[model samples]
Target: MKQWKPAASALLAFSLLLAGCSSEQDAVSKPPATQNKQEKPSQPANAAAGSETSKEIPDAVKKPLKIAAIVQLSIGTFSSQYAQGLKEQVNEFGGDVQIYNADNDLSKMASYVENAVSQKVDGILLDHGRADALAPSVKKAVEAGIPVVAFDSDLNIPGVTVIDQDDYSLAWNSLRTLAQDLNGKGEIVYVWVGGFTPMERRNVIYEAFKKRYPNIKEVARFGNASQNTALDTQSQMEALLQKYPNKGDIDAVFAPWDEFAKGAARAIKQAGRDEIKVYGIDLSDEDLQLIQEKNSPWTATAATDPADVAKLQVRFLYQKVAGEETPQIYSVQPHLVQKSALPEQKVSMNDIGKYVEGWGKSDAAISAWMETLSKEQKK
Candidate 1:
């Protein structure tokens, strides 16, 4: 399909340049859910869509459209894959894309947004940032006629389009499975974070879940970090285990993010508490392995294909940049994945496409738009 290959020299140069900007954060090199540079790159579900070249590539798409892709963190595999998708799609479409890693630094995020406006980039892709800090820059971009597409960002700007993983559904599906597994009666720990859009949305459901399952007691609550995520959470989980040492005291855990789930699972395993099950949101090749393991406490998760979401965000940006009518707010749906349903072997992002059907395809409008572009090629 559409091939987007980054220039080796340019990537290397960018890496070197970025090296000085922020200290290298430790990357959690674990799998069934995270990224490994050595693993084979899996084709996306919509790979076929890229095979046919448009006979008439839009002049806007043909010219190397400059894009400023900014992210909150690069330490985790999910975030990395998300960033990777944006870069690859832009490159494949013959566009110039520069990724700005904020390392989850709020001030840095603001700086990048302001810099993008100053640079007069054709478009800006804001990934997982706070709206309060980004509003001014976003307003500047809109005033300058620059399109900005936000993924999991809380920015409430008038012109910018906001896209997000259906956080409520992701939590509802996973928690429903957990409630069923527990027969709706158990003491569970709640691990969550505030400030991020996706987390905030999921929290809404978390509150609803508590109200619905009145018997499921939330004995404890926790949060996550933008750096050394898994490890930090694991350490936090260890402390939690110590506080609630009795097996019967903590029957289950609801860690909405995979990283938090992973940490909770690791802590449970280390404490030799196999009976306590952990449910989470988000999955990857790395995450699948953990679920497939014998006696693994991580029982289930809900997720969308991060790679697919990333690529789709880029496509949306392209369409908007080309004056296509897209929804002001686009939501990607998620699915529940239990441990029993996981493949024995580690699964890549490609394999996940089946579970999350139409992972990146937002609506019929997107497909119809593509069809129009295809017919234009013939004309």
Candidate 2:
């Protein structure tokens, strides 16, 4: 099986790095009565069909390719696992990978992208930044013949591909689950931020969710994304708990980001408000542990493995390098994980697939040549 690992570092700013945070949307949203299969990572059908000879390969796709991964934040285990997958995939193809984390600074992230272009790296993989901050650098990289692939950022530049975890669907899945658990009526706390593409999309779904479940009310709302996201979130959640000291004052926390989930869960547990549930949108080793803990308030989350996401991003980058036709936008599918399904005996992300169907690696963006490259690398 392909090795795979979110909770991006869990808040990715948990959608924009949080300062003070806050959104609305339309259309009543509900889960499909019959769930559809997760879509595979996609590319042009022939994107994978490369000629067999070594001479057929391009220098850009060749081994020792120098690549840069510019990330907006790297505070959590989710980010570390993502980097691990990237290195793992790049290693299979034999390349030099440099990952730069901006510590939630958009300016630094932009600079890192510019630096990558100046260095003439073969490819750039970007995560979580604003369009205004990143578009110019992304265009620069493309103009220099360096392929740029982004995850959770808005870059409309031609020749750059954007990958996302379908945050709207992710949020809806978890929110829908929460609604179902509460029988469509409950008071919820919203932990969120803005200025992120993923977060915005999720917010769209959230707005729809509220419209659909008019009975559910948002009692308290608070969130921020920072270097100390979990800690800050925990502090905020604690404060909210104090404001609503009575049991059942907050029925649940809709933290579409894993970092927010972690914080809310901790706060609820610490306050001995085990009755409040947390519904989140990303997962990691730490997240899984929390969800599985005895009476963890964090009961459910929707996520795709970050490592698998990293590997697919690398594959798409390589595909672009090979002069293949690739899609402009690709979404990594997410799966709902209920704490009740996970084994209590300690399991890692790599092994949790058995417990959660569609939780591990995917064929998204995978090509025959890519598989061939992996086999070749093994030799």
Candidate 3:
């Protein structure tokens, strides 16, 4: 074979390099630019394992827990409304709430508290029941690591939180309205049902009225009576009216609740004293209807939003159970509602009485009221 020249070998080497580069370019150009479907490799094993672990944990275990509510009485529009509110809020927050009604029996309330403790409830919401009566049970539960929250009625006991209405303010404002309506002077007959929070509020109102309005005289102080016992309230009212025959002297009658006001209204009507102004606490739909009907002399009422109070109490309890910080006491503001302030159409007793029965009978009416209430709240 003839010996190859150095220049020829170098040129051959250059040609081979060019051929390799051209082949690579052709391979790249062969695939469609828009049709490339290559997938990037997945995350490393450690990161993938961590993500899987995170997803396996259940939310219930990671988040807050259950609550139990104890109520004083099973009946009445205010209590029922509050219970409904509490239930709705608890359901919304992904928590369990069990409500127990003591039926106005203190012993029953104590038993319910004990039962709740034994059940290992994460928290408790006490409504309109004496704190002192349930203190032992509450203390035991707290020692067992469960928290207690009180609403409407408070014990002022340590380690227990209270959420309540400004009773003193409510009393002051209500009496002031009565005084103004009576033109700064009148003989006022006061009636109140004893037990729970209202009794305390009644006492406050009486004291404040005496101090603030020397012109307003207390014509009568009636004892504790159930709201449903209209006969008893009527008897008491009649007795007072008989004692003070001159209707001109009695300018107003003050009742602590709507039902009591109803009794007073019946007595006032029977006595034919339409000029006497009637004022009371609680603006239950029944009372609202009474106000709207204009049949009764119930001109104004000092109203506390029990539903809002219940919701706030439940929210505070939820935070405590969830290991979140919250206020020791949450106060619900009260309003003074007059009949004139209500809607122009004026709902009838026949229509609103259906709602006063605890959202049980009339679904449509309850829904409408709830919607209206929601709108009012937003405003």
Candidate 4:
């Protein structure tokens, strides 16, 4: 994408117009909500529209702000959707976001942050970067006076707002349903890897599940996130099925990431292991299609819309840039989706919320001026 740098004089004149403009239309603004792992998700307040008055557009956003989106990995449908949402939201601000994809290399991700700092971008958005590798660079960026917002990162620096899905619930929502389906007694293969913050948090819940259900034994455990995560997972799972080599040897497979779930579900289907059920976290159009396959082993999943997640990240970043107070941490609630809850026909993220409440909507970090900004973009 071409870089956009608007003149300072134009921004000054626009900011005055924004500060004087008033809107009678109200916008909804609410803190991010959390739901009990076992309960159905309640409707989130409509952040796209509502009854609360909104503040004027900040002077910081009057110009075409330059944003840098640094990511550790960008794989799967969710990743693509998230990027699309982020771009659309940033577009509303008449800004551009340059994505620096590290392709799963933490060290490379660090250098991208340093590069962004060198560019003196208006703001930085981080995704899935380790604190040890990324924190120092983040400090340098903060020292340079750039606002930062992180999603599913371990960076604990001051003046940084962190955002993530409720990983604990994402795990328990699927795990609990699996335990109930198996009556708390069955052989389960655990598909997981450590290092990523979301994976690590979800693993904590997995450990609790092992202790909670003593009878539900673990037969095999193996996973790795790579360039071809889904295909690699499928090959590994195929080998695992061979090792077990019996109908009852593996009763259920718990894959917290959709890629792993898709891999495991595909392997099970190929092996004719119809008895095994795959429970996973995160959902996408491809994943939903897999779940709806004839006698597909993949069943329940817990997730928020990947697009909505990106939308929130962009809003939070703008909030910081606008010099508004922002929560140090924000958690977007995850919802449980069972195969039985989906309609018989196909659907995509654009329509998932029609069947699942709160799947594709959020009100966190929304302000009245944002609605006006969005309309301005369309006009």
Show where candidate 2 strays beyond 4 Å: 1-59
The C-alpha lDDT values of all candidates are: 0.71, 0.77, 0.61, 0.79
Q: How does model 1 score by TM-score?
A: 0.80
Score every model by TM-score.
0.80, 0.85, 0.71, 0.86
**lDDT at 130, model 4:** 89
lDDT of 1 at 160: 70
Q: Summarize candidate 3's per-residue lDDT along 214-248 as a digit string, tens digits.
A: 88788777845453555677778888888888858
Measured by lDDT, the strongest candidate is 4
lDDT at 363 for candidate 3?
Answer: 14
Per-residue lDDT over 274-303 for candidate 1, one digit per residue giving the tens place of the 0 to 100 score: 989999998876777777777889998988
TM-score: model 3 vs. ground truth: 0.71
Any residue pairs clashing in model 4, and if so which? none
Tens-digit lDDT track of model 4 for 150-204: 9987666777777777676677789989999999899999999998988987786
What does candidate 2's lDDT look like per residue over 196-225, in tens digits? 777877886677678778999999787887
